[model samples]
Target: MNQSAAFSPLHRLWHSRRFRGLVPPALLLVLWWLATTHEWVSPLVLVPFGQLYDAALDPQVFHSLAEGIASTFGRLLQGYGIGIGIGLALGVGMGLSKAFDRIMGPSFHAVRQVAILAWIPLLTAWFGTGDLCKIVFVAIAAAKPVVMGAFEGVRSTPAQLLEVGRVLGFSRLKMLRWVILPSSAPAIVTALQLSLIYSWFAAIGAEYVIGVMSGGIGSVVMGAQEHFRTDVVLLGVTLIAATGVAMNKGLRGLPDYLFRWRTRA
Candidate 1:
């Protein structure tokens, strides 16, 4: 057998998504273990798995982290709902009404151009460094993409489809339900995915910026950092990465699952 032929299966496996995905983390874990065992760096910087286990074993540490995650998730959901609700409504109006678009589009565009983080300070000042501030900031972060997604999606609906809806004597609401929304759903869905991810980012940022006194995963990390609890800090970092990744996977096709009717028309 030729050498290339003999190696083909192994080469293919190396490039496979599942294989590639597993390998980097496996390599990092191996490196982490090696570094810890050899004491390659200061223990204060890179905490060993033993210390991580010890931190996790502490009931106080474990519970605080858990509570923090729960609160963060709660705020994420609330703010996300408010943000997308208004964003979709406004986007639909703008898409359907030239006058509304003209009245609102410039301000919307101008506001979205500002970096999301820039709003944190103003939000914190206006709303106070509490759940209100955090939730509001997250809402702002979640709204922009959703607005654009829904706007473009609706605007891009083919003229033929609208004409068909008209020919069928569909009412405004029926036309929107059967023709406009279905046609624009893909873009809207993509925007939703983006909004969810950005909402999480905003949630964490707000927690960090507005003050952890309110309690959230950001608080967990910040509090641990203040005490120089490197092990707990490492644990918090791991949790953040895991949560973000889980969300990405969990909601990747969410619109398809939640709004199945949107695709059916």
Candidate 2:
């Protein structure tokens, strides 16, 4: 039960994929530092690694980044939560009832075909360039994948198992809770992950296009682009990529724990 024994080198190595993945980037960083040291690449375009790191540490930039990230993450989570909740509810409803599916499936598919970006103008008009607009974008992006995944998951629930559940006096709600939900959990997890990624992308696009005026990673990139500061842009891109990876890992943990029953199933 020793903590050190529990967290061995293998565990450390496994959990350190981010650090390991940084090797190549680290090498590239070294190369860039060397190039800048030697004045090989123009200092104006390719800022030195040290300077980039320094810029990131700058109080103004750091404060801006913190504010931007907090704002964007808040919006993203709000939209994603709404999307997941609604999609899951309706998906279960449609999957459980053939009449419901038949009634709404076509319209759902048709609307889902429309890109999230396509709704930007209307969303802006309705909600303005505020938190609500960003939420709308994130929700639209998150909803479709979740709905699709839920539809497939529910539709593919084993017919024989469902019949058995009905024969056992399982009510519809009981059946969904005990049978369908367990079976479709993996798909649901995948859908959630996809929804998160979609939300992330949608938020970025909305911020970029509408210019939220508030701080966000997208705002940082926009500012950098406006100032012709490619280095800052590169830094923003790197931060975004890093943050996405972290978020993906956080999401993977949820399914691993929630669907642990699958290991036996």
Q: On residues 1-265, what C-alpha lDDT tens digit does candidate 1 reach at each position?
A: 6999989999999889999889889999899999989999888778888889999999999999999999999999999999999899989889999999999999999998999989877887798898989888988989999999999999999999999999999999999999999989988989989999999999998887779899999999999999889999889888999999998998886877877875785
Each model's lDDT = 0.91, 0.84
* Residue 63 miss distance in model 1 (angstroms): 1.0
Q: Local error of candidate 2 at 187, Å?
A: 1.2
Predicted structure 1: lDDT: 0.91
Worst 10 residues of 2 by lDDT: 210-219
Top TM-score prediction, candidate number:
1
lDDT string, candidate 2, 122-216, tens digits? 98889888778888789888888888888788888999989999899999789988999987878878998999998998888878986658567
Deviating ranges (above 4 Å) for candidate 1:
1-12, 255-265
Candidate 2 C-alpha error for residue 62, in Å: 1.2
lDDT of 1 at 16: 96
Off by over 4 Å in 2: 1-27, 228-231
* TM-score of candidate 1 against the unseen true structure: 0.91
